[model samples]
Target chain A: MKILVCISNVPDTTTKVKFTDNNTKFDANGVQWVINPWDELALTRALELKDNAANGITAVSVIHVGNASSEPTIRKALAIGADDAYRVNAEPTDAYNVAGQISEIVKSEKFDIVFCGIESSDFNGSTVGSMVAEFLDYPSVSAVSGLNIENGQTVITREIDGGKEVVSVPAPFVAIVQKGIAKEPRIAAMRGIMQARTKAIKVSEPVAIDSLTEIVTFELPQPRAKCKMVDAENPKQLIELLMNEAKVI
Target chain B: MSVLVFTENWDGKFKKSSFELASYATKVAEMLGTTATAVSIGNVDDSELKSLGNYGVKKVMCVKNDSLNVHDSQTYTKVIAEAAQKEGAKVIIIANNNTGKALAPRLSVRLKAAIGSGVNKLPLSVNPFVVVKRAYSGNAYAQVALKSDIKIITLAQNSFELIETPNDAAVEAFAPSIDASMVKTQLKDVQKQSGKILITDAEIVVSGGRGMKSADNWAPLSELANLLGAATACSRPVSDEGWRPHDEHTGQTGKIIAPNLYIAIGISGATQHIAGVSSSKFIVAINSDKDAPIFEAAQYGIVGDAAKVLPQLVEAVKELKGK
Candidate 1:
């Protein structure tokens, strides 16, 4: 089975977020980027699917929709055992454009299964995978915690409000993964890292898609005010302060 | 002008977040001087869809298709886009759960609409449109304006009140064209974790941290949460240590939650941790340490070991419920 996993390069979770150019864009200086946490789930699942297949799964291709700065992330994904990699040579500015680029590529390849993280940790938009599936006119599922594929069919389980729901669909679908989908992702091994150097890294120019939205300015979120701690012995004191000072109750 | 809302359903029933979206769409309709209509998705019966009229939906459209039994984001977007266009909808509202998050962006592209996700309130208009949204993992809010004619907004979970009406609404069946070839990814098998309420839509949450000491001692927390019909959650340290699943982690780098009531047991609220549940309406902290940071955010705090305080509080609630 041919599987395509879409990944994004994001700042490490511990990095303190900061914006540059007068707070109009995210500052990329002196920041270590890692494969987004959600994307890791997708990659791990794809690798697992490949491992269990008898015909020796053809390839687990990794695709990143970003500019030159994202190359290191794509390389890291390769080191983690993706068969090959592709970097769409463009700076993704909006969701529409991102989805359009993925759709343009998929029109030719026709991957049997496409997987992405539930949402990106940085933008947290959670829209691109679904948009890509919609643009491609393919089936899609989101925030799936568990998945299995057999006999040209896939079964997925996801959480709902009070409980869980199990759903089934045929192959050539899109699935966005979340936690509990698999065990903590395995770290890249030495052999995998060495083999990634010889693997193909395909570069593709993004197709032109109409851009309908733009971010005028990206500003830092307001800092929270200093916290006021009340003595724990007296619950009444805290309630009084909440009603009078915070006025939340 | 009329607004179109997508009521996401699972297992022949509507999701709670969909109800919150229903209430929010109604208020938006009230502002725009129009009525709100709902399109219920999934394997939902007409009767359950009609009951949504209590939340200000005047009409509910159920799309009955066997192919739609499982949520294919592509199919749902196509169907909802057609419904909105057919009804000449000015605004489209959906819940910002996993499905809505994926559906809205795609729908925006399909319908040529301006899209906003994680919205916390109705639009503020003054010759233009602006929506309030939670950003920076709920530590702050942003007001964004749209310049597009067609507008799509996804309401944040538990952000709006669920309003009820005295009468039932009307229901209608709609047919959606499907491209059988569009079905690509097939679902395989599901592993269900035994639990009470799913964390995302829970109104009340009971969470624990490293204070619980061991994984085997989680029964008390589950027992307490079961009593309140609450969802169970944990801090990052607990989840990182494999005491609980990562989905249950609540912190800045974890799942952000805003429930009506939050009970923190034996937790010292780190900055990352507080960023997640700071929006909770009422907070109750129980810790042995008098200076635990959780006390600062809690509405009511008790300086006692959680092992002792939890049982007492559970008994108190059980008595209050006459159980």
Candidate 2:
């Protein structure tokens, strides 16, 4: 079985996001780039499935749609135990185009399982995995928390509106995974780092697609109103404020 | 041409966010000097479909079929794309929820329309349309430009209040091209939450985090939630440690929610977690650490041990509500 995991390079969660070029582009200065946390979670799950001997997984590959600047991010995925890497050198203009490009590679390659983050951290589109599934005309499940692969069938458990839904599908389906896919993402060991340096990163041209939405300007949310801090020692006062003042209770 | 709103309906009624989108679409339509039409799918009752009139939609077009019952992005995109073509809609609206997350991107690709997800405010200028959207979780906003003639928007929950405009809405039956091949995957079974209100639909939420100490300690917080008729949620760490159900995890990668009142207990307010509830109308944080980042987003805060604070607050609420 072969697994394909898609990763997005995004600014670290701690970074203060700012837009430049008259708010048309993201300001990259002093921003620390890292593997999108959501995608890293997916990668962790993909690696776990690949490592389990019973799954009979052969290759676990990571794919990205970004230009040269994202190479380091792809290498990081390789260090995290991806067998190989592929970069569709292009800007992910929008979720539609991103899904379109991913469908191109997934169709050409015969991977048994395709995994992507539920959404990219930067745009938070939450659209690519399902869109790619639609583009590929493949069975797709979104926001799955638990996955088990056995006997050529993958069973996924996803949280629904009120409860859990369990669905089983054969190989060759797209899974858009969210947090808790793995407890903790595995960090690269020195040995793994050395191995990743030699692993091949195949850079491929992107499928042609037009971007739909464009950023016109960027602004900060209105500053939060000053918080009313009450005496923690007095819980009765807290309750009073919640009722008569806040009207929450 | 009309402003088309895709109400991702379920059993019989439209979801809360989709209902909000329907109301938003009507207001937008009135501004653009056109009518608002709501497009929906699944097994829906005639009266339930007609109730959209209360939200100001002029017409409702519903596609009924068993095969389209399950959440299929491909089929949903096809269904909505067909509706957009039929109505000659220039602006399409949807909710930035699970259904919209799956359908909008594929629909945009199918219709070659400009797509904006997490949209909040109305269009600033009509000539070159610009819509406000949240970014970096919820710390900032960006004005997105829709360059295409067919502009699609997925509005964030709580962004627009669903006020009754009162219109005599008409329901029309629609049947999109659905083949057997459309059912790519089958849902074996669903164990949905019953009896209790879901956090996604709750107006008030009381959430606990690692500060709650353990799963057993969730009792007091749960009591407070029950007293207020609110839903319960947890921070990522609490869910990761099995202190809470995965469905109750509210964070960037988990569930993004926007209730009227979000009471966060024991959470330090991580950036990703804040993104989930930042759109909330009011936030109240309780933590032992005064410097917890959650206080920044919270409208009210209490620096104390949740174990001590929760019971007292619960007692106070019980007294106020005269329970």
Distance from true location, Cα of A145 in model 2, Å:
2.0
In order, candidate lDDTs are 0.76, 0.84
Worst 10 residues of 2 chain B by lDDT: B9-18
lDDT of 1 by residue, A40-102 (tens): 878988898788875346889988889987888888899999999888899986667887888
By summed lDDT, which 10 consecutive residues of candidate 2 chain A come out lowest?
Answer: A157-166
lDDT tens readout by residue for model 1, B165-210? 5357788888777765654434443446555577777888999998
Q: After superposing the true interface residues, what Cα RMSD does each candidate give?
A: 4.3, 1.9
Clashing pairs in 2: A162-B193, A163-B192, A163-B193
DockQ of 1: 0.26
Q: Highest lDDT: which candidate?
A: 2
